[model samples]
Target: MPKAILKLYLILKRERFDIVQYSTTNAVFYAATASWLACIPVRLYAQWGIRYVVFSGLVKIIFKQIERWCCRCSTVIEPDSMGNLEFSIREGLYPRDKGRVIWNGSACGINIERFDISQKDIWRTEYREKIGCDVHHLVVGFVGSIRADKGCNELIAACRSFFSNMPMARLLLIGDKVFYSTIDKDLRDWVESSDQVIHVPPNDQIPQYMACMDVFALPSYREGFGMVIIEAEAMGVSVVASNVPGPADAIRHEVTGLMVPVRDAVALAEALQVLLRDPAKRTAYGVAAAAFARDSFEQKKFLQYVLADKEQLIAEEEFQINHAGKHV
Candidate 1:
């Protein structure tokens, strides 16, 4: 870790960058510290999500302190979601002044044109057939890591209970199980054995899978920002997400998607059933969701926002430099 920090510090010093941004646990901690030491004018720790929330006791304390240190070194603590910024400030993790959330709360936002494949009916049909889905199937899809934190277990249980009545219904789970997966044995076994569930190893063809889905679901326990929900929205897929910070911001309950209580399989099942049963409501939500994604969370707009922010910060930095020079 120290060597990596030193290497990053040297790179920052050599580059003399106006801004340096990093995310995740180790990268944020090391890179922020390095950027601070290198005296970069803008050291940004772009926190994607809070990992320490899942831990407890001394372990959680340790991780929180490490994150606090990382934030201290950073000029800005940029959380992707407003809820995350509020949580960090409320917890005293970072000075409220230093924290900010970018437009509409996503890591980078989604490309609407890329996910706007609703017109590609042929590919959608072929993809569904390849994934073992029949024309009769009512597919609900999830795209993310398969872990306890992601509420994969809850989704599995919910699908099993709910989809039993409709054998034609399918659960399409994308992404692979990580080495240290905290998800239930039921999820692990079901992924391999269950005829009702279809598992696709983690790949880049998410929009393709999204095209085949009737509904998208994200029942995460916690999230910095539910980027996947926005992606699904871009694909004109109605979602059922957990009523937590990240997903809450990504989805508007009853407007674009439904929000169920976190970790509650029954509520999750019931919510999914609503969309599955009511084709008209589902279509309405999907249409609204696509409009929302295109209007607010387009990738180009977000990139422009970030670029403008950097330009403003650079101008401020230059003014300070000039002011200091005149005084000297």
Candidate 2:
């Protein structure tokens, strides 16, 4: 670790970097420290998610402390979600003054061009048929890590309950399943045994799959920001997400999508059923959601916002450095 840090520090020193930024825990630790040691004026750390919150015992303690040190080394900590920024400040993991969220909360907003609503019908028909489902099937899609933290177990339980009512409802999970004990036993059994569940590996064709969804579900326990929620909306797919911080910002409850309490299987199931049963309401929500995404969440807007902030901060830092050097 020391050798890696020195190597990075030398690179920054040689390049005479005006700014340095890092995101992941490993990268943040190394990059932030190297940037700090190299006396870079703008040291930014992008907080994507809180890993320590998921662990326990010594592991949690170790990760939390490591994050704390990373925060200390950074001049600014930009969390993609306001909820995470609040938690980081509340826990003193990052200073309140240094933490900020750009726009509402998304690392990089969705590319609306990819999820072209003009070709929605074509993509929907194509992808649904490709996945062996037709217009008759009620598809509930989820696109994230198939792990405990993503609320996969809760989602599966909710779908199972919903299936008892609408047997035709299919759960299309479009991410790799993680082999961990944290995954529910019932979920495992159902996935292995039931034909209603379809597991697709992660691919570049996310927008295509997203267009076919009757509804999208994100029952995540934690998130820096639920960017997928916005992506689904861009595809004109209404969402039912956990009323957690990250997703809450992405959705307009009862308008763009429904928000269920975190880990509440019954609520999740009921919300899914409501949308599935009422095509009019679902279509209305989808229309409203797409407009919301189009108006608010474009990748270019996020890039502009962040780049403007970066420019301003870097200028301020350099001005201060020159001011101090004159005194020295």
Candidate 3:
């Protein structure tokens, strides 16, 4: 680790880079250490989300200290969500004044033009048919990684409960089932047979899949920000998400979509039922959601935020050249 840090320091020193930007905490530590060692003028860290739950107490503390150290070395810290910014400030990870909020809290916004309602109908027909769903059946879809931390188990449980009551309802999961546990095997195998559950792998044409759902569900316990929610909304699909930090930021309850309690399968089931039973309400929500997403989470805004101050960064390079010339 020390040798790697020294190598990074030498590279940064040779390149004479300005405004070094680090994406994750581990990267932040390396950048901070390198910048301090090489006397680099500016450093910045992007705090996307908290990952303390994934690690133990001592490791969490160590990671927090690294975050603080990186923040101290950097000129700015870019937090993805309001919740994250506030948490960073509270935890002394970054100074309140230094942290800047990017629009909509997502890494990037969906391409609204490409994800049009006109392109959705064909996908809707095919996917519904594949799941044995008819016009009368309500289809709910989840488009992301099939991991336990993403509340996949909770979703499966909720769908199981819903299936017992409403056989006409279908839940389609569209993503890679990469992170399967021993406990998940029995339930997952059962879902494959009995329930109206379909496990599809990762595909390039995700927007097409988003088009097929009447409702999109993301009951994740933690997220930096849920990007698929925005995509689903752009494709005119209403969503049901957990009332946690990141999902709450993405979805406006009773407007664009519905939000339920974290880890509460019963609440999730009830929320799903609301959309399943009322086709009119679902349509209204989807329309409103697409509009809201278009207005608030535009791709142009994401580019503007991410590309802000680039000209200034370039100008700094010119200024440094002129100053060095004068001295020489």
Candidate 4:
């Protein structure tokens, strides 16, 4: 850690950067420490999510201390979500006055043109046939890293329960099976063997895959911001997500989508079943979700907020320097 900090310090000093920003916990620690050492005029620590939420004991303490130190070293603390911003303040990780959230709270807001529903018909037919599912099949999709922390096990269980009632419903699991060796053997075998489940490797055609889904599910244990929820919504698909901080902020329960208790396979399955049975409700939610996403989570609006914040910070720094010079 010391060596990494020193290396970053040298790089910052050499570049003479006007502003230094770091994202993610690991990067925040090293970059903030280095930026402090180099006395960078503006040091930003972007808190994407908290990993220590899932950890405990001595390990959690160590990580928490590191996060606190990173916060101390930074000139500004920007969290991607309001939930996370509140969490950081409650935990005393950073001063509330020093923190700010960008727009509606996401790393980057949805690109409506990219995830637009206009191409749904074309992409749905192409992807559904490629994945061996008929057009009439009700597809439930999940896109992200397939691991325990992402609630893959619970998702599998939910699909098992959902399939018992809606046999024709299909589960389309996208993304590579990261940490596959660490996952339980039984669950791994089930995913491989189930004809009702189609596990596709990660691909760049996310917008197209999202267009093919009737409902999108993300039963994650933790998330800084569930960007995919908005992405799915932008593509005119209703969502069934865990009632966690990030997801809760993104999804308006029973309005844009349903939010079930985290790690509860039964609730997750029941939510899916409810949407599958009611085509009218699904269409209603999808339409509302798309409109909500466009109004609240547009990329242009988010960028404007962020760029304006940066300019304000820079102007404040210049004012301070000029005022100090006059006093001298």
Q: Judge candidate 1 at residue 30 and give its lDDT.
A: 85
Check candidate 3 and list the clashing pairs.
Answer: none
Candidate 1 has a TM-score of 0.94
Q: Residue 297: error of model 1 in Å? A: 0.9
- Candidate with top TM-score is 4
Instruction: Report the C-alpha lDDT of model 1 over 1-328, residue by residue, as the tens digit.
Output: 5999999999989999988889999899889889999999988888898889878999999999998899899988889988889889888998888988877778888887778655646657888989988677899999988778888889988998867698889999898777425867766676678798888889987888898899999999889999999999888899999987778889888999999999899999999999999999998998899999888899999999988877877888899899999999
Q: How do the predictions measure up, each by TM-score? A: 0.94, 0.95, 0.88, 0.96
RMSD to the native, candidate 4?
Answer: 1.4
Q: Which residue pairs clash within candidate 1?
A: none
Note the Cα lDDT for every prediction shown. 0.87, 0.89, 0.79, 0.89
lDDT, model 3, position 106: 76
TM-score of 3: 0.88
Off by over 4 Å in 4: none
Model 3 residue 24 CA deviation (Å) reads 3.3
